[model samples]
Target: MSLVDLIARADERGLAASGLACLDRCVPLLGGDDEVLRPLWSSLADGGADGDAWGERLAKARAELDCADPSADTVPGLGPDPASGSGSGAETETEAETEAAVSDEDRAAALARRMLATAPGDPCASALRAWADACSAAALQIHRLLDVAADGDGPLVAAERRRQVAVLELLAGRGAGGLRPALEVSTEGRRVLRAVVSRRARGRS
Candidate 1:
């Protein structure tokens, strides 16, 4: 089924998992640890998105992402390396490069954090649908920002859309049992993104 069809049919748990899994897999873009969203997954497993444990776990995940307080509204800076030296042309170039990289990372982190923050604590069908749509847009935007390709409608965007649909379909078809397979799909995407980041770094060097 198409992602929209699958999402339209999904219950609250499947919808939530679909969005959360997308963000969880993209955690690497935000410089997050791989297991950072594990607690949220446990909450989904225990009783879906509206479970008692979900809010607390979600808060914890936000905190770990340095987005604990929504009011903070600040993106963490990627500071210049101490060893890069001071007041030299090379140092200035390095600082500019670092800032640019940080800006991309911050943009990705903000989207991921928004995906978490916007999750309905007591998700209804309407709320889940809205969240899912927003996640689809955000995930695509994240991929676009990180993509090395100059073309906006390149392979990265296409792949992200496919992954998004696949996760939702996996959940819709298999219930909670689909979580592992969904995660595996996310892992593969993460590896692809890591390679992109590495290639960018190499180009810079």
Candidate 2:
């Protein structure tokens, strides 16, 4: 099924996991460690959306990551990175070239931060649906901003889209059992994002 259909059909746990997976994969942009979101995951495994653990963990994560509560548009109207289409992610050979590259990264980071900030403290089914949908959009955009393929989405964005689907499918098919594999899928994507961030930093330098 399409991602929209999968999300619409998902239960509370599935919805929460879907959104968390997206945010977890984008943690690299927030400069957070790999395990920063683990607590929230654990809360899910131990009944996250139904308790205070998710909220506490989310709060702690925001503080630890130093996610500033700034309004969106950190790069004002900085929309999709052209890299997702015909632009390239490897054009930073000088300060002048780095300007646009840095702006894309900054905007990507801003989107990531907003995902964390907007996550609901009470994670109800109603609230989680919106959060999940927003996370999906933000994560996809972040990947698009960082994507380097010359033709289309490139490997990075393509893989991210696939992983998002896989996470939802896992949750849909396996129920709670899917959480483990969904997390695993997200971890693999996180590693990919971290590598991209590292490569981009070196390239800009």
Candidate 3:
């Protein structure tokens, strides 16, 4: 079935998992640790997205991602922290160059942040449906912005859509057990994104 159909048919848990998986996979773009969302995943497994555990874990994940704690925002995967004020001499020049280099990734990260924020803590069918739809658009847009391919329907967009559908299908088919496979799918996408970021850096140099 198509991604939309699968999402429509999915229960509250499936919808939440699908959206969280997408955002978790894209966390690398936000300079987050690979396992930052692991706790959230555990929450989903333990009691789904509407429980106290999910809320606690979600907040913890956001804090770990530097979304909750502004002081920790160091721009690990994307680029230099924008708030780091201009330095003098060579340092300033280097910062300027880095800033220019990661503009696309930064934009992509912003979209990822939006996806994370849009996720419903107390997810019901209606809320999960809206969040899932928004996440789909955000994930696609992030891929489009980060894609190095020439303008058009490139492989990156196709791959992302396929990944999205695959995650939904896995959730629909396997229930909680499917979280592991869904996470594996996200890991593969993360690797692809890391490679894309590296390729962009190489092209820049």
Instruction: State the lDDT of candidate 2 residue by residue for 2-73, as single tens digits.
Output: 989888999999999999999999999988899999999999999857799988888899899886452332
Per-residue alpha-carbon lDDT of candidate 3 for residues 1-205, written as tens digits (9 for 90 to 100): 8878887888888888888878976887778878888888888888888899987787777777767642332342343333334323245566667767766677688768767765666677888887787678778877888775768647888899899999898888899988889988988998898788778878989
Could you tell me every candidate's TM-score relative to the true structure?
0.77, 0.84, 0.79
Of 2 and 3, the candidate ahead on lDDT is: 2
Q: Candidate 1 lDDT, tens digit per residue, 1-205?
A: 7767877888887888888877876777667877888887878778888877887887777778776653332233433212223223343565666666676657676766767666666667788777777677778877887776787767888898898888888887799898878878877887787677668668778
Against the true structure, candidate 1 reaches a TM-score of: 0.77
**Over 4 Å off, model 2:** 68-102
How far in Å is the alpha carbon of 160 misplaced in model 2?
A: 0.7
Q: Which RMSD does model 3 reach against the true structure?
A: 7.8
- Worst 10-residue lDDT window for candidate 2 reads 75-84
RMSD of each: 8.9, 6.5, 7.8
